[model samples]
Target: MKFDNDFFNTEVREGFEISSMMKRAWAAQMEVFQVVSDICNRNGIRYFADFGTLLGAVRHKGMIPWDDDIDISLMRDEYNELIRILPGELPYGFVVAGMYADCERLQNAAFVPQLRVIADEELWDFNDYMKYFHGFPYQRAGIDIFPLDYISKDKEFADMQKQIIKLGMEILGKWNELNREGSLDKFVSEFGQLCNVNIELREDTKNYIWKLIDKVSSLCYRDEADYVSSMALWIDNDSYKMRKKCFDDVIEMPFENFVVKAPKNYDEVLKAEFGDYMIPVKGTADHTYPFYGHMEQELIKQIRRVGFKGSVDEFCEEVASGRLRV
Candidate 1:
């Protein structure tokens, strides 16, 4: 996967280094793209550049100058194929996460049915900060792969679907807290306090939430809906619904001296999302967070103080149970 000579030479706004953090992030994102593309090609799956990735490929011929992450989307069937084969196909240190993934990394995190191709790496100084204070695992850098779920063309139903999934995610976050503490009673009491409703603590709540996610994501897939959405994004008065053709008929477009899949009718797709994607927007693009290859050491000391050398899930459990203080 040869990239253009200037592929890594993107300059960002003032106070940001182009050659250090930007270069590493670009290299990591491209590497992950190669892996994902290879697996898809080998296994007969379909995927395409999406969101800012699609905008960049069409408007700038590569990554947006200030953007450092990759975004792609896969239709329902192809998403299933990638999920089934990614575990064995990805090289060591990379993981395919989301609802279909069984990786330990997501075992205790909030559960959503979307997909993310993560490239795991060694701990950084910030890992200590995140682990102790935030209860977050060692952050990985990779592409955000969204699954295009079936959605209705009707505004009311589409909005309703978004609301349903949002509530499910809130419940999943509560479920993660329950898992972290290993205490249903603790979670139930907290949930009651938050919602002002009393209910018995039961394991079925988690199972039910999981099923609700499956059902909502499957709603459009089961029928021939006229629209589709990434379904992972939070709906704050924004609609992700795009015409079905934006996903069905794909065409390859130039991206950093290579070609990647994109919608055939990208004009309509882009217009629906961004009124004029061709024109450069005012000011520089904002930098995406959590890119790999940078860490601070003072943070590492804070993590080692915890004295726990187990999976991130276990460490979170300890923190939840008051055995370890962040």
Candidate 2:
């Protein structure tokens, strides 16, 4: 199952276009990765590069050439500690962002926790809505930190868990529809009408649903389950699961100019997720992020639509304060 080195070698690997800007974005992510690694090492937290990151390590000895982001996963308990301590442990400009029960768009389950380290906004320069949508500043390059949770071996308990994830996913679909094309007030008004609720009550209901999803997902941790997956992505079967041993230990791998932790059994981890881990896909935009491009006027329009008529910093502040409402 070995791919020829020439097959993986390319001027462009995953259709990211290999520009200076893209290289800077990858560099920025690695900068954040280094900081995250330092914090985890100091606090004795366990984490490993996962998903495309692991693929990149196994195949390229670094970033997958077309890839621009870093992915890492921590087991449940280690994840909790990292989330709790990261805000204080990270340098002044870095922050961790995730869904809070009190935040707007609580029905949105599309994002997971991230360690967002500040980059020059001019460098990444994403649109205001992308930043506003996540309550992160435009200047931040985020390293995604997925939390792996145990899966119950019991059939009944597993069924219940799957149902909760299904319901949460359904709500996420609805949330995306309502928020896809509107100002914050318009989204609230439209969603309230759709749900037959008062506009004021819609947010509370959403937050409650999000809280339940979080609570249901956490229940598996108490059981002595032998398998784990990132339940935040709604895993319901063994296909997404791996032996807990896959993550119980680690080995460091070179990523660009620096070394980062990877699973001790990364070959098995990659094999489980991607059948032919070394094979290059032909002509795919798999590495491109949805929010990577932002024309200046489009960004301005999105900023004004969110009711902000100021700088990116001001817009981010409004979003962070919960005043922007989306």
Candidate 3:
């Protein structure tokens, strides 16, 4: 888990230097990935480095100089199996969060279907924790786990499935907005008619909608399909759609100081995702660089101002209740 200072300070690109803080964040995420890898290995489940992470592994032999997050993909059934077993298997300081995982705290922070394996731990002294971890105080770091589902071979059915998923996502967004605006009754009345189901507003309404979306995304079975894609990302782009054989086997690849699992057909996968995968396209990452540093600093200041010495979950609830002034 310890990285040499030289490694931290080295420039992966000519003009881009990895800050020590960013290096620490990368280390934290690597720990999370290791934990996940171990569990999957023990349980006979398969996963592969995905998207930017896979690109980085094949091209840079480590994290991309600018990217701050790690992504991995699992087939639908294995993804579900991981979710079912992860709760009982995680180490003391780790927790899984997602609509399906039912972790309300982190789920409310970002209502997405992709499961996040977060490093959730308490920090009684924010300064000390920050000095040691060189990352966020609360939920220190995490990795995203996206589910790859089967896509129908028939073009028409596949297109229809895509449309249904798009509509489901729109409905989920509106449901969140309406619930936030205290118009749950209105949402039920309107979308209920659209979905052709009498959805009564309840504590689990959001979960109900999430399940509906997942169900629609998984209408096609893997055994009957020629291609697989990340249903959760279909709303964004079609790059994720590829031949099922691309992930049929995995090969170990160098990633920093560790060897990690990657698809044997990584060349094809990368070419599908990013044309000319070897070319460096240095640009802003999907998230702000140094991931949570700014937000964590703000939270530390707020905690100090209010003289709060409670757990991170309690602080989150206090802020959500509108009783704490940021």
Candidate 4:
């Protein structure tokens, strides 16, 4: 069906005024990308622009004007290398903020594996937390980095990995006995001793479990993919379908100036994941601030159209000082 009224169902596209904020954000994003790309190029880092970012580069030459995030991926070792090299090399107000697991908010699922440099603090605030998870810096608006692990493709590895998990679950039952209670740190510290118990009991459980951990760790790395971006804000099922329908056209697009790899099966992937990719689907957002002026513009076009009634000044004031104290 065409993108007429019936099929397009959703709230306004949201945060229309945020576009100004987004523009400032996009400029910052450009800065981060240039720096990161330079580092990667100089150090021979293997990187790729994946997911929405890739799609954006392919389609918009930069960030999809309406999207709020950016993602990039690197191979396992290269990811580690980036971690090792970034702390000392970053320009200013930016650094590889390290893994969020060690942070006080360990349980906040909103915190993704990689952090980005930004001035915002929250994850959903259109002006503040607009940027959820990204690579580098601890700022609110910035790019998120992802590490791709090479999962074992073989059946044996998969089987072993599963068995190892089973054995580990058994060990977890006794974790409290060794540690105070819910301390991942304690469990890991005592992991070696537990393995000995396995050998003394002639049980393959502990040994196998450790091996699995090692393998999974060595399976390269495991982190979010860079594709969690809003490359095409206008993508409805039909538009997404068009992507798959014309996979060959998914070529290099200008990403922060240069080009990066893009998905070849854009349409197919979206269709498979969301049935019809053209519908104005519900997106992840922070409801407190505001919403788009036209979420289902095409739909609203046919139905009752309510003009936006907000302003950027109402939500947040520009950083009048032109600088933030780190």
Report lDDT per candidate. Answer: 0.63, 0.62, 0.74, 0.43
What TM-score do all the candidates reach, one by one?
0.67, 0.68, 0.81, 0.49
Backbone clashes, each candidate = 0, 0, 0, 24
Minimum summed lDDT over a 10-residue window in model 2 is located at 1-10
Residue 106 error, candidate 2, Å: 12
Give the number of the best model, judged by lDDT: 3
Candidates by lDDT, descending order: 3, 1, 2, 4
The total of clashing pairs for model 1 equals 0
Q: Which structure among the candidates has the greatest TM-score?
A: 3
On TM-score, the stronger of 1 and 2 is 2
Off by over 4 Å in 3: 10-12, 122-138, 174-197, 299-326
Residues 46-76, model 2: lDDT tens digits: 8899888888887888877766677898887
Stretches off by above 4 angstroms in model 2 are 1-17, 100-138, 176-208, 234-238, 282-290, 295-326
- Judge candidate 1 at residue 90 and give its lDDT: 88
Global lDDT of model 2? 0.62
How many angstroms is residue 256 displaced in model 2 relative to the true structure, after the best TM-score fit?
A: 0.7
> lDDT per residue, candidate 3, 1-326, as tens digits?
55665654435464688765567678778878999999999999999999989999999998988888899999888988998999898877677866765556656544676788876655224444343343334454789998888988877877877765676577677875767889867755555564567778777777666766777677788777987888866557876677889999999999998988999998988887777989888874766666776676776677777888875435543543345434
Q: Write the per-residue lDDT of candidate 4 for residues 182-230, one digit (tens) a residue.
A: 5544444445443343232222333334333433433422232212212
Q: Which ten residues in a row have the lowest lDDT in candidate 1?
A: 129-138
